[model samples]
Structures are given as C-alpha cells and as structure tokens.
Target: MAASSEEFSVNANEAIRISLVQPGPNNRLITKHEFHPKFTYPIVGEAEQIFGYKGLEVELLFAAHDLRPHLQCSYVKKFDTVGTTSALDLNKTFGNFLPPTAFQQGFESEVLDDSKAAEWTPPGVCVKKYTRGGENFEVWAGSLLDMPMRTLVDNIQIFIVFFIEGGQFINLEEVDWTLDRWRVYLTYQKASKTPTPNASPYLFVGYATTYRFYKFQKPPKDHIPISFPPTETITPNTLPSRVRISQFLITPPYQSSGHGSALYQAIYDQVMADPTVLELTVEDPSEEFDKLRDMNDFDNLEPQFKAINLKIDTSPFASMDRGRLKRVPTARLLPLDQLQAIRSKNKIAGRQFARMVEMYLLAQIP
Candidate 1:
C-alpha cells in the first residue's frame, strides 16, 4: 500500500529535494517544473469503488519551488459508461479549474512555410537580433494599438500568472488606444539550421509591458498661464518623459538563457533613442528583477562614470584643519554636478542612481 501511494505521489519528494539545492553557476533559482500524473482516484471511497462507476482523475501539473512546494492540478473525469471507455475532454472538464499557465490546448505549434511563417512574427517592429550560447533570438517592439499585438497578448498573458507571483491579466478591449502610452516588447527564439519540420520557426520565449507618462517639466518663471478657447487646439507633442515597465516575464524553459537581459537592454536602447524620455523605471520590481536591473545598469554606467573620473572626494579629511573640523560636509565631499550629469545621461531614476553611485564610491574608498 505504501509503495502504491509512493508511485501515485508524482515524485513530490524529488521536487522538494531539487528545490532545496542551490542554484547553478548562473545563480538562477529553478522555480517551476512540469510533472506527469501516474494514478487516478476518486474524491471519496476506495479507488476500485470509483472505477466501478463515474470517477475523477486528478493530475498534478506543476510544482512551484518553495519551502514546501505548492502543486497546481488538473482534473479529468470518466465521461463514458463503466464498460465502455471514451476520450477525455481535458479542457471542457478542467479548463477553469486548472491554472491559466497550464492551459496550452489551443496553442499547438502551427506549421508554415517561409513566406507564411513571417506572419507569425511578433506584432512589434523588429528591433534587433543577436546570438547567445549559439542560440539566435529576435526582439520586437510595438504599441498595444497593433491588432496582432492585442491578439497575441490575449493568448500569452495567461502565462503571466505562472511566471509572476500575484500577476493579473489585463483587459485588452477596455484599453484606450488613443492614449498611445502602452508598449510591448517580445523575444522569440529563431529556429536553428536543422529545424524540426512543422514546428514554428520562431518560438515565443518572453515579453514585457511598459507605460509612458508625461514628465513634469517646470514652466518658466516669466511664463503666464492662459486658458485656451474651446476652438483652439493644443498640439502638445505629449512627449513621454517617464517610461515604467509594468510586467516582465520569461518562460520557465527559457529562463537563465540571457533572454531577460536581452529584452531589457533592447527596451533600454529604445528609451535612450527617444529624446523625450527622461528616465526608465520599473513598477514594483521583484527581488530577482531588482538584481537583474542592478547588474545591467551597473555594467552600462560603470564605463561612462569612469571615463568622467567620477569618484568620492576624501580630500576633506586629508586637510583636517581646526576651522574645517566642525563637521564633515557630506554633500560637498562628492561631485554632485558630475553625478547629476551622469544620472541624466544614463536616464536612471534618482533613488536607483544614488544606490549605484554609492556602490561605485564604496569600491573606490577601499
């Protein structure tokens, strides 16, 4: 009996063991795993009693990495009579009960020739493509207004809940396209030289969402406010000054493959190209995301900061004269103007810029 239960346990112990182990050299935690169900039983009564009549088979689909793993399950009930067996409708029976991330029934890979395959390309305009670890990937950027983008997101957004804790789906229909503030970035893995036949040439790997808002620019002191007449039209460019990344996700299969960094860098490059964008920021970044952002931003800003000779001034302590011994001028110790210039040029937010500056200064102190 114990052995039978063990077989039906879906190797829950193994999952726990793996979750306990440290991350690989890449420093990425393996947070998700797919499992196959090996046994079926009823909610009540013994297994044989349920098999004698109508019964439900519960399949545990995914195990999330945690102190004690949480499992996501799917159900399949016997639809036919006791003697006769028929095909089980996994979607019709268990669609709503299963996690949205587990619903991939309609997303079967569609085969297409080269010409027809181009249509499968993500909605946004192609940004760039590069190779990493011998794997080729492309980045695309487009506004939410694009019809293809809207359609694709409707299908892919379901996976957000699985990858992002506490993530919720957004209503595409209710979105006000006239605002033109939403943008999506998608990354796809390009097929290799010997690609599988009938398989999609480009496999969707990950996506990110960003919203642009007007940066508050102070009005000139001499400028006076004027109420415009109803007939007058204000053609404000509405230049986006602040762009905040709302959601960022890379599929479990593709995580730790450098796709996240690629997607982020592509978006950062786009922000830099826009003259109106004063800063790039994230909305409620998770711990993992914060680390990723810090690594990328530090790598990007270090060279520029070094080129300008940006460093902490400890010389104030060097000249410990009686008149200057009253108190340490913390603000005056650092080159504020140079730091501000670097911050502006890099488009990093104030708090984030300060943290990076502090790290750089501390490194110089030793």
Candidate 2:
C-alpha cells in the first residue's frame, strides 16, 4: 500500500490548475505584517477635555520607528451667523500654530558693508563673524544684563515654541537681568547682498542661552572670614566658576547646515578660554542634542586620550592580601590620576567626561 501511494501523484494539468489560484488580501500569506505601527494618545485635562481650546481635540501621534513625534489637533466650531458647525484641520488653519515671526520671510534684510562689519569686534565683544556660503553670518555674545542683548533675545524667543515640543514663550521682561548669570548667543545672517537704504541689515537665524553659576569651594580652616555689609546691588562679576548650556535652537531653514555645530563650538571655545570656568556642563538635554554633544566631545578628546595611551589594564593582578583581592578595584584597573588631569584641562563635566573615557578605553582594546 505504501508503494502504491507513493506512485499516485497529481497530473501536470491538475498541478497547473492549483498553481493558478492566488491568495486573497485577507490571507495570512498575502498580507503584509508589521511588528509595531503608529498610534495616538488623546490629551485630556481635568474636565476630560483639551485645555484652553473649546470644541477642540488634540492627540499625540507616536511611532516606534519615527525619530520625531507629532501632535494631531482638530476642532469643530459652530458659527452663529452660519448656524452650522464644520470640522477644521488645526495644522492648515493655524499654519503649524507658529508665530509669523518664526518664518524667514518675516525677517528684515541687511547688507554687510565694510563700515558695518567693523562695528562687530572680537574678544570681549562679538566673538567671531565670517562669510559662509555667500552669506554674512555673525555670532554676538553678551551677558543677559546688557540691554541690547536682552532686546534681541526678546524678539526671537517666540521661535522656541515652534522648534521645541511643549515649549512656552519666555517673558524676558519678567526676568531679573540684574543677576548677571544668564548669557545669550545670537546668530544673524545677512538677508541679502543688497538691501534698501533704510532696511535692517541682518536677519535672526538662531540663539542659545547659557547660565553661569557659582562653584562652591571649601575654605581653609586657617583663613579668617571677612564680613561685609550687603549693598543695594552686587556687580555681575563676583563669581562665575561653572557654565551650563541651557537652551539651544536653530531655525528650521538653517538646521542641518552646520550652523548649530558652529554655534556650539563657538560657545565651547568661549568657555574654554575663560580661566575661571572649571567645568562645562549642559542642562537636561534631549536625545538628539545629546548625540550631537557626544560626537563633538568625542572628536575633541579622542586624540588627547590616545596620546596618553589610555587603555584598560587587563593584565593579571599583582599578588595582594586576600581581603584586598576579593573586591574589584576600578581605579586600579584604569589610570584615574591621568584621566582626572585631562578632564580638568578640558573643563568637561564629570559624567560626560567619564562616558568619553569609557569609549576611548573600549576603542583601545582591539
């Protein structure tokens, strides 16, 4: 019976008929599969409705494979005059819900004449200015207390709302500029090679805000305290020992063109030049910004670490007492003193510096 069954097979005509039939869309074999797809979550307030929006609904769209998440805003509004309600696409109606000034077209035009360029000096003034890609760009940095710097920041702060998620407008007027802790860096571009006689010469490109904080130090026991009466106002230069980059942003059009990198490097150079700045740090950073920082810092520190022959010591441990052998000596495994000296010279924050050191050590392994 087994031999007879083996001999029995479908004819060529029957096989051709079977092969002609194709699976339907709903068939498992024909359907496309996705491990994870896009999804949305409703945003609700205390009343289970969107806040500050009447008859409007908002949902946050997220996807596992997407780099940037977006918000879907919709609204249903009834007009008394028309006596009808219509659904509205918030994105189209509000034009991305950004202020008009956020657009490049809204900026005024300026030409970079020789006399105008001379006004921007270096060192204590605007750190650097140059022409790139047929555009005149300048980086001006000053303390927040400066009236002109504060005014410039106020004009462009609205862009933060468009670039940053859940970002709100900052009211520079309410800030106590007298503290002298905040520093602003502005990037301006020459809007056109030829400008009308009265038109402004430059357009706003991007800006970053940095904070200088006091670094507390332990006073020697033998040192005597000198008490002084508090004055009406203290000067801005009492102490600036540590610096933190708080907010960094580049306009949509200017992003990915190396402007952001240039701004960051300029700020880094300025901080490094200051002898008082013991460490350079950043406030809570987004993943994207963190990646940018890692690339920049790694590039800057790689050569230094390599020159010092920084590598993991995987050799056999020296003979020691039983008690000391039981525990892992992390410091002994790596050159802690040399790393500390390099970190101090570079003025890198402790946590970031450690990450770079680990990467360098791993690279040296092979």
Q: lDDT tens string, model 2, 1-366?
A: 223211222121111110101112232111111111111111111222112233444432211110012334444542222113232333443344333332323111211122343233311256767777888887878887776565555544434543554444445657676577778887766545322233234455577888777665546899876863332133354554778887888765576777887788889998889887777888777676787788889999999898888877755356666676657577877888998899989889889999999887777665
TM per candidate: 0.67, 0.61
Q: Whole-model lDDT for model 2 versus the true structure? A: 0.55
- Give one clash count per candidate, in the order shown: 0, 1
- lDDT, residue 153, candidate 1: 69
Cα lDDT listed for each candidate = 0.60, 0.55
Cα-based RMSD of candidate 2: 17.8
Please give the lDDT score at residue 232 for candidate 1: 17
- Per-residue accuracy of model 1 over 143-192 as CA lDDT, tens digit each: 88887776666555545544565565666758777677788898877656
**TM-score of model 1 vs. true structure:** 0.67
- How far in Å is the alpha carbon of 216 misplaced in model 2? 1.9
